[model samples]
Target: MSSAAPVPGRFTFVLHSHLPWLAHHGRWPVGEEWLYQSWAASYLPVAEVLRTLAAEGRTDLLSLGITPVLAAQLDDPHCLSGMHHWLGNWQLRADEAAASGNVALGRHEHRLAAHALADFEQRWRHGGSPVWRELIDGGAIELLGGPLAHPFQPLLDPRLREYQLREGLADAQHRWGHTPAGIWAPECGFTPGMETGYAAAGVTHFMVDGPALRGDTTLGRPVWDSDVVAFGRDLHVSYRVWSPKSGYPGQGAYRDFHHYDHATGLKPSRVTGKNVAGPDKAPYDPELAAAAVRRDVADFVATVRQRLIDEHDRTGRPALVVAAFDTELFGHWWHEGPQWLEQVLRELPKAGITVGTLEGARADGYVGEPVELADSSWGSGKDWRVWAGDQVQDLVTLNAEVVQLALDTLDKLPRGGERDRAADQLLREAVLTVSSDWAFMVSKDSAAGYARDRAHQHAHAVREIAAALGTGSVAKARELAAGWCLADGLFPALDARRLRRCRDEHTSTVPTGHTSAVPS
Candidate 1:
């Protein structure tokens, strides 16, 4: 007699790792610190865990969303030099802490700093691309590409939107010698007709929040008539471990993120309690944190298994459950997060839940019928309000003006003047101005000033450069573009002439269904 097929179903973790173009910008309390901290505490440890799993012959483990902007910084010479210097400073700070008689924190920090320094020298000396290339080439992780600078697409000029998505994938191809089929869609932000752009760029699948699908995220659904799939994140499975109210990271036994040792620049306290002050929290103990990791790992595994089993039972078909999170959460916000992740990935497989990438899930026949996706994001209320709301309406207008200015200037360049340095840099500045990070900051009220200032600064650069090009002084235009390029030069692959061709082609190609606006 034939046996019934097992139905526990598929599971995968999607980590969207991104930061603004912070290199050569501010350093101390804001910019470079953010980069180095996430590098040391998050990227390094997470990469280590994935590599370890790969060594055991595991493949298609998770989908990793490394935005083009972040990849540029990780591969930039200036940022790598700064990262090295920062690691050296970390060691010296640890020595100072030890000299000041904080032996426990001092010793712990010293080891961490030393290990990070060695890791950077040995693996990251060439930059993060090679590290990612290893995983991608080995089939250990699926790469999810995004727009040139993680732009919030809903409010962007259609011409600029197509250019950004095309160039972003080109950026990935230049780095890894292949194009990605899926994207994270910068904060999971989307609206109707964006699917036409996705199809134009050859994107096959992308992510959205569960609420975007009205909470029916058990499978991937096509948007309208477009074949490009929209994968809804399983928020119940994800938020159970990182929600606003309660999560594993909030346990009193885990290391506290908010509290830090002012001297050594390291966190040395446990959460202690939900309402406890940072200064009053207990000293962090590895044993206790380890215990919490174990418990949380078990709890999370149970959650994934139960979610998969329940969905399968209801549908009589295996479902795909993707738990997505910010990559910075591991080792950066939650110190033991990487360890917990390693455990989750390892345990899920043993629990009869197949751990695989989204591509893998789809290949294994985990897909559903098509549906018209609503305008939504993974932000507050699964809507475009976070990137287009009244609070960020100023940024919305600014992005519109900058994108239009960029396209008009690039479009009007004297026939064959497309490859001009001024034109290339104008596109660069304009792309940076549209970065989704700005609206995200304003919406969340976190570093709103910095975000606004960055957006305006880039927009101003675009305006000034466009004005210079209009002056008939090609020399002065080149000078201005070069100056800005020195500070904000990313996307080394940006070709004004090539983009012009694509822009011209894409303009006529945009379907009538391709209208982009905020949905009320």
Candidate 2:
């Protein structure tokens, strides 16, 4: 008999889909433009691929985490308008390019751009309609929820954390007709007390990075103090697809993200030479890229198949490999990402890998011994330096001060008419203060200045409320609350009573030892 090991019982793909709320707000390098681009390049296209697979009767399993912020934009009337206009603009641009170029170049550009626009509108634009519902109904996609604004939970005030979680769940229910069973945890930023919040919110599972499991790479399992389960992304298998240095997207044959032409502001070429100048780009051929995609898919599937066999041989249990990545990396960052994804899903099952969603693995009886998760985030270096780095020191300090101010103000307020309003306002300001955007922007160095400004803006609101409470300036407090409400639009269901309850509950249950907020 051949000595080949049995195939893995399951595999999971978790795609975390998020973009900041950017309808009428910031644009260009940092705001709504980011939203539209991701919609065009990633969200719309990814959804189409899943839908196509389902149409073909291939329900290859996947879990998708669409942040509440993105959901809000998706269902918002204003954003719908903006996105439609943006698509029309893209079509116009393609038309202009086709008219101006040599026949061969022009025709190719026109066909590709028109195909993209048509596909986006046909699949994703219907409101509360069937795009997401089709996937959910079909068993192809498991929806994962996250906080309203994607806050870093470990650093948030206890009360505000509950508000963020509860409101996020509620919003998901409002949009999708069901509560999300799992959350993406807004950057995979998990801390010890977060399980309590997840438990309170009725979330049964969440995604955490593999390093959080110490060296044990497992799939869906439980964590300390939480009846809720945690699924760790299997980095060994995932890194092969998109590691920092050697991901499939970085291959010389793929489309280059960094070398787009500034004048046309469009990517016109394949990644020719690593050292080639930006403007001196070569042409992109979908046929050539398709060949590369097939090779990468074969390599990736082989890696997963081998890793599962190796783990089973060593552990005497059916092994699981959970591959997680940012949803945007698919189409926005890598032009052929959607194509690769479709091919990989179609190919893997034939290789004897049972594709599974996180929930599917759990349902099949994968469970872990309870363990305390170290503070962690899946960022550069897989540590807290991104959130607490020197670049964002001032914003971090401001966040801490604002959180304290909001908490102290809530503590001082009596339970009743005016005091209730004041507490709610403080809670809103506090939740906005803890948004992960500021720290993320600073860490990426993409828009550090804008992030700093936003943090200070929210902090100023918190301070204004604190000052009003201290001086007993009731009228001023109400006015500031009204003004701040416009900018801090998250957590619409925030309740001050919940904040008070969490504080009272936690006061008597403090851990014996304290760990640094920054995970080692």
Candidate 3:
């Protein structure tokens, strides 16, 4: 008897690459190390995996979100040079290891170190690897764009929100050679009215966590008031790969993320035999870890395949399993992540799974019904507590105060050249005030001091501009603008006249709680 062929369903993966604007800034806790580590462990290695897949003609459908701020830093001359130097240093470290007595460590080190250096030089030496272009060109990956600096959308003043979205899209177009159809809303921070902004900017779809779908984690669907589609991450399939407690990385064979030697500053052992400390760790062996990677990839593929089969059986439609993750989690946190990714992509296709991007899935009619979305983000508790928590409460309050001040000042300015300049500065200040990085840093407790400093710096700029306008100090206003120009160098497309017009048109209709002083 002949057997029936297995039906294919949609399986999509979205990787969001984000790092704050950290160029020419270095101070340990939250500085240049963040960029270097991600480059070494994540970007360069991940690029290689995607490139390998494309070369094999197995360009699996994947969506990648590289935030504009991260793009700028990646393309910066200083960052490129620093990465080159770091890659060379890694080669030297590998050579030293090879000369040591440890044969297994030496073998793996020599191979990976050489591979990483060659990959970095060939792909990312100048500006950035054309990896993004190659992926898009080869149909291996779809690029999802985001705001210029990855600011939280809901908390930002509405006037500045448009500027952030517009400039962010413009930057992506300038760098990547095309405007994106989708966005990874910085931190998945979505609000009801933000849809109008996305619609105006031409973003047809964006992502949110599974919980944001009113607990219905299915395919992409439109929001209530707007035509734009929203896709929710499938937490069920995703957590299996990397959950807080039960992830593959926490397995005994994986390299320990927390216990790198401070003196050598390199990870020298695996988390072999759970509860064992780093100093007492077993010898490092890539072969053992590769076995673990194979097992994890199998688990992930089975999870995806089974989920799709179940959903297809239930709905009688090709169901989608959308898996989302931070790009850093691969190389930076889970050393075998790049390996696992390669294996998963290769194995899934052979298993009768149709790997696809968000856009392709939507185009194939994988959309569902619309619903009203509540305030949500993909943080620790799947809420806004990260941004509005006690750690950064003071900065949050200060941000609110300065935003209100800027709005108030814009309200009083006369419609002339001076008013125009003031409006531009007010918009700049307002957007910078709502950057999610500050609150995130504080909440993670990685660099609370730096976060507080950035918040205050932007707040000071807003206050200075407001003070200059209040006293009619045009010279001081120019000085403050020049000073603030150091950090808040975004929104070159911002037109003060439009803001002035918005203020003039909306003054009478301003809501009681809304800040109308700043033009939207």
Best of the candidates, lDDT: 1
> TM-score ranking from best to worst?
1, 2, 3
Clashes of each: 0, 0, 2
True lDDT of residue 211, candidate 3? 90
Better of 2 and 3 by TM-score: 2
lDDT tens readout by residue for model 3, 1-520: 3322455578999999998766555636567778988988998888888888788886646899998878877877777887778777766766666666555665676677778778777777766626687787788888899876788777666665665787788777877687888999998987677787899889999999989886556678788778899999998999998876788888988988877645435677998867797789987678889999999898898888899888888877778889999999999999999889888887887777888899898888889887787678888677777876667678667766776787677767776553355557666766666678889888898777887877787788888888898899878887778666655554455555555555543332212332221122
Choose the strongest candidate by TM-score. 1
- What is the C-alpha lDDT profile of model 2 across 1-520, one tens digit per residue? 2323438567888999987656555778777788888888888778889988988887646999988878777776666777778877776666665666634444665676677677756765664236787788787789899887888777665666676788888888877776888889987887777887788788888988888887566546688867888888888888888887778898767888886544445666788776777667577666788899999998998888888888788878887789999999999999889999988887778788888788777778877678888778787766677877777777767777787777777767765443356567777766666779888988887787877777777678888888997899978887888777665554455667766655665432212233364544
Q: Cα RMSD to native, each candidate?
A: 3.0, 3.6, 4.5
User: Which runs in model 1 stand beyond 4 Å of their true positions?
Assistant: 1-7, 503-520
The total of clashing pairs for model 3 equals 2
- Whole-model lDDT, candidate 1? 0.86
Model 1, 315-343: lDDT tens digits are: 88878898999999999988899999999
Give candidate 3's whole-model lDDT.
Answer: 0.77
